[model samples]
Target chain A: MTVTLASLSQQTGLAVLDHLERSASIPVVHGLQAQGDLIVIPLPVIASSVKVWPDSHWKDVPGEGVELLRGAAGGNPHTLVADPGTCRWTTHVLDSDQLAIGVFETSAVAYLLHPEHGATGCPPGTYVIRRQREHEGQRARLVAD
Target chain B: MRREAAEIREEWLGRALSTLPADRPAAEAAISGLYHLIGLAPPRFHWVSSPVTALTTVPPGIRTRPSETADRVSAWPLPSQFSSLMRQLCLALDAQVRWGHQSMDRLIRQKVRSPLALSTEGSLRMPLLAAHDSRHRFQSTWYDTQCVSWIAHYDALRRAAGVLFTPEQNRQLDLWAAVARSGGWWWPREGACVISERPVTMRTEVCGDDGEVRLHSADSPAVRYADGWDVHAWHGTRVPSWVITDPSVQRIGREANVEVRRCAIEHIGWASYIDQAGLRLVASAPDPGNPGSELRLYDMRRETRVLLAVNGSVERDGQRRRYGLTVPGFLDDPIAAAGWTYGLSAEQYSLLLRRT
Candidate 1:
């Protein structure tokens, strides 16, 4: 299935969805996995994201809430992504719903994987696009019966 | 486009392999070993709040005044281990640049002028070219590879930290970042090494009072400055006051007169010349309003103007007359006559020998 950031932003509410169509001299999207019609690339996948996450401990994030998205932006609230460089593997497993909308055509994906293009590595074939509740926050404490 | 560490390592080793005549396996293994060691500790980032003190409006030449208020500034410290890794990596990088120079000389001798060199030997001393060049080829390539790898990593780190600076901060930060990029080659001499475990911002520590030892009024002796006699001095907060005074005189009817008391002291903002009796003679004070904090003293002559060094050193200039003193008849040696100066220790008398 094919996807673009415009469609992803409708579902995810992230502005980074808008940049998916822009072309870069270096391929930002190394590879992609499908979740029905959705295309998901890993969060903080770029070398530049190393700055946003900085340390190994920040690799794991909690939920796909607005608060989480804002924090990931590193004070840039308008977007959900920092400037992307070449791709690298991340231990972080972000939900497909949380990922910004984007798709790389087969040729584009091939360009990224090409040795000359200097893509770090390709993402795995399948993605675990688990769906969670829209508002995954703590419930009010129940009164004792 | 940023290349992965592996891709960079591969390209480098491939080039090295091509350059080397033999030992391909060993060269490859050595390159891999270096890669593993460097990869073991990748640079990491941290968000931290550090104490910062800001100072404004510093007087020129004087150290800036340190502020009293405490400020919390956000800063990122490179991982502690990275500092050691950086030093090691820098030494290796410097070695690479050195090998490049070495190879150029060898290439000229072995390839360009080999025939000429053979003719000069005259069958007496035959020079055999060693196979060491092949090994150096691998090492040279490996070092170059590591340099590229390190540069990429450092560039990434800088990019990651790029947002920390605003436009104004960036202009200054870029200057420092440039220094930091070349910083891998900077190594201190063998005796002293001060390594910082964490990244730190530059700071100036200004004190309200210049740290100079004040002399008690009683320690100063009275002195008279003669006209055409020059008093040179260096003065500042940090300077220690030492006055080296030499008095010269022409023969009088009975006693030697104080003709010229030439003295040079450390120029602080203010300095003066006094007679040996600890009396105020001539004062040269720099204008406090002048930002230069000028450390210069002018010639002074007069008994009333007192020469005071807040914390300064005074020294005798070379022109102090050597022949004016009369030698005792008992001291027969001409060397002693030339060396002897009244009121000086043997050590001081020896120092006067250079004048002769």
Candidate 2:
């Protein structure tokens, strides 16, 4: 079955903007992809910087979806959406720079839905999700766009 | 039970951030009831337009205490006495909860009480306190007691969690709820009580999973009062008005705070600021996942260079937003700098498939 913004919005009961192409099937990518301030990369790509803990706790991504990050001002979240039992997320991954929010493993295609940025599909694999940051004078501040 | 607690939390949160005019009569009656519990006569009512005004001026009939004055609203003992009264009521209510209900009680504290407390602190108390003094010298029990988060927690216990309360305890809770819903912060004294009116306008952004909010506005004051007292914020970080109104390259250069400088630079788009500041471009390359978009790197400060990138998706107005990310000055390659942001190597980022 083809997955579009309309179908994801309907599946999660979330509203998407009219400006987005509602009917076009979303593409599934197997490589590094970014959405707004978050970047999703395959686990092996950043193995030096990210490590999964031995006692990592993982939770299944429910049918409703799991919210990853909520954008500032607009307050819309980047939700990781997939069929139940197909994916799980763990926040116990260690990042050298402390940027990783979690690691997600999906047996099937996983969709990340957002209101303004539309939706992007992630093919089955283990991926690390990290937030963007900018250098301040002497500090590093997380980017919240 | 969590859902029910959330509903109760929303109801109280609405009242906490309310900009509505005060209900004078209801406030006075509930306040009188509270005074009656403390063995004092109903104090005369003193109303002020803002918390700052309440701090700067004393009520007409009362002499002042140094601790209770302007920025030192912390040292007052009366509010602590009221806090004790509340503490006793909570201890009584604690007895009514059973073993099974204890977990529900903890969940209520997490889902409703703690988040509400955080929201109250961020949205109301912090801004008002900063307005008077930035050091935050005064104790917060005075304001913390007045915050409806705790009251709402108890309310959830009784109404939603089905915990029983003594008739007298319920009566006191009702009085506290009435005073809270009636108006803003209040100060109880020996023979008088002072109350402040809510802000005339407040703008906030949702900042947390549990419905927390913080003040934020781009061009206007995030919070304003009937008087002219107002606060300007940039995405929840309090900032000077110039950062919003007149963000110039010179002003940004002179600004000592790096966060403020970033906010100001961002107020003007990164691309525009780079152009206006006349920073030399180090390198530019096509963004792999974004198809037509380009990633340009520019010299920003002594040890930092900014990478200007275009949004992967078009906005509602048919324009793509340009954003800047500050990276270490060492990296000369735009793709390498972008990879450093996510802890990836230059080669790892080149395989980017899509961005949207």
Identify the candidate with maximal DockQ: 2
Candidate 1 regions with alpha-carbon error over 4 angstroms? A1-145, B1-79, B98-265, B268-271, B275-356
Judged by whole-model lDDT over C-alpha atoms, candidate 2 comes out at 0.87
Query: Could you give the fnat of all candidates in order?
Result: 0.00, 0.75
Per-model TM values vs. the true structure: 0.17, 0.91
| Candidate 2 per-residue lDDT over residues B177-245, each given as its tens digit | 999999988877778788888888888877888888888888888888899888888877778889988
Categorize the docking of model 1. incorrect
The root-mean-square deviation over C-alpha atoms between each candidate and the true structure, in angstroms, is 36.5, 2.6
Best by TM-score: 2
Model 2 regions lying over 4 Å from their true place: B1-6, B66-72, B100-107, B135-138
Q: What is the lDDT of residue A91 in candidate 1?
A: 31
Give the DockQ (2 decimals) of all models.
0.00, 0.67
Evaluated at residue B191, the lDDT of candidate 1 is 20
